[model samples]
Structures are given as C-alpha cells and as structure tokens.
Target: MTCKKNMVIIRSFKQRPVCSECQMRSLSGPVSDKKFKKLFDIDPKFYETSAFLRDIRYQYSLYQNLTEKQIAAFKRVVDEFKNPKKKQINAIVPKAPTKEEQAEHKQKRAKGLFQSERSTLRALRTK
Candidate 1:
C-alpha cells in the first residue's frame, strides 16, 4: 500500500497502511490551522451540529474560560465551516447520474434482502 499524502510505499500497519512518518506526525499533537482547514472542509451546518463542539461548549459553561489556543482553534473551525474554500466546492459537487444509471441502481437495490417496505413495493411495481 501507499501513503495517501505522499504516495510513498507505506511502512505502517497492514490493516490501514500509511507512511510511518505521516502516522507519527498525525499522532503527535493538535493539527495546525492550515492542516485543520484542509482536513475539515465540511458544511456550514457542522459548526452548529458538531458533537465535539457541543461537548466543548458544555465544558466551557462549567469552567467559564478556555485556554487562548483552544478559543483560537474553535474560532478557526467556525470560520472555516462558515466559508468553505472554492476548491472544496468543486470537489464536493458530484456529477448528476443519468436516468438509466438511476434505474440500474434501483434494480440493484431491489435485489437486496434487507430493505424497507416502500422499496419492496417499488421492486414489485418494477417487476
């Protein structure tokens, strides 16, 4: 296997191989602002919906103060969540599937045993 970041032959675990250096670096400490931004380019709704943030808010409520670095990190996450990069916008936009492809997907889905009653009815109708 190869490293996702550098495409070098991974010298890490076989289950989920990554570069040894990359793995070590990731495990060391808190991610940098630029790295954090690149990693978590999620929907703006995430700022409101994140469970981690909820936990942090609860902690803050009890403590009344967070460290400067923690506050800065929170602000950074909120800012990034609110305004996703242009590259992320393009990357996230998936191409529309054709009607034939959609039909094929429905057919494939219908063949599965574990599905809702609605799907069962649709499968029957399709037949």
Candidate 2:
C-alpha cells in the first residue's frame, strides 16, 4: 500500500490592525480630551509612533490658543475615524496659514490703509 501525502489548507480571514501611519492620519485634526481618550481606547498603540506622539504634544501646547471652530473641526474628523464606514486611507485635514497667505493679508491691509489716508487727504483739500 502506498502512503498518501497530507494536504493542509490555510485560510486568511482576519485583517491586520491599523498601522501607525493610519492612526496618525486619523488624529491629524484637533481633538479634545474626550476624543483623545476615545482614540486611545480604540488603539493604544497609536502613540507608539514618535511622530504621532510629537504631534499630540504640539497640539496640546496650543490647547488654549485654538479657536472654537478649529477645535470643532478636529472633533468632527476624529469622530469620522471612530466610525468604521468613514475611515479612509487619507483623511482631509485642515492646515494653518502659509507664509504666502500672511504676506498677502499684510499687503491687503497696507493697501487699505493707504487708500483711507489718500481719501482723507482729498477730503481735507476739498474743505
């Protein structure tokens, strides 16, 4: 009688947990303590990444400086992450103003002041 070889089949059904990059993207927007806790509860390993931890620390540093709207936007993004259907590979996060916006804003302000001054001088001359 010939011996029969055994056949083994392996089935892969489980998905790997979210990676650090994904978790960090999930936290990109501003978050409150409650939202922070919720995220930590979902994945404690999120803070394992150095960059993610640094960002969290940086955001905290400005805890008192952020406007209500900014904080709310952050909360909304975090909430999206909490829900599985809304989870995405790359979330759209709001960014702060760039040097260009600052420069343009300054130029606009200067132009407005100059126009106001010119109008005042014209009025004085007419009177």
Model 1, which residues run further than 4 Å from truth? 1-47, 88-127
**Which candidate wins on TM-score?**
1
lDDT score of residue 109 within candidate 1: 83
lDDT of 1 by residue, 3-116 (tens): 677654435554345444454444334334564444344453453455444334434544645677766777676776677666766568988899999898889788864467
Q: Please give the lDDT score for candidate 2.
A: 0.53
Candidate 2 per-residue lDDT over residues 52-104, each given as its tens digit: 34344346545624456655654555555557485454566667789999899
Pull out the clashing pairs in model 2. none
The TM-score that candidate 2 achieves is 0.25
TM-score of each: 0.31, 0.25
* lDDT (CA) per prediction: 0.56, 0.53
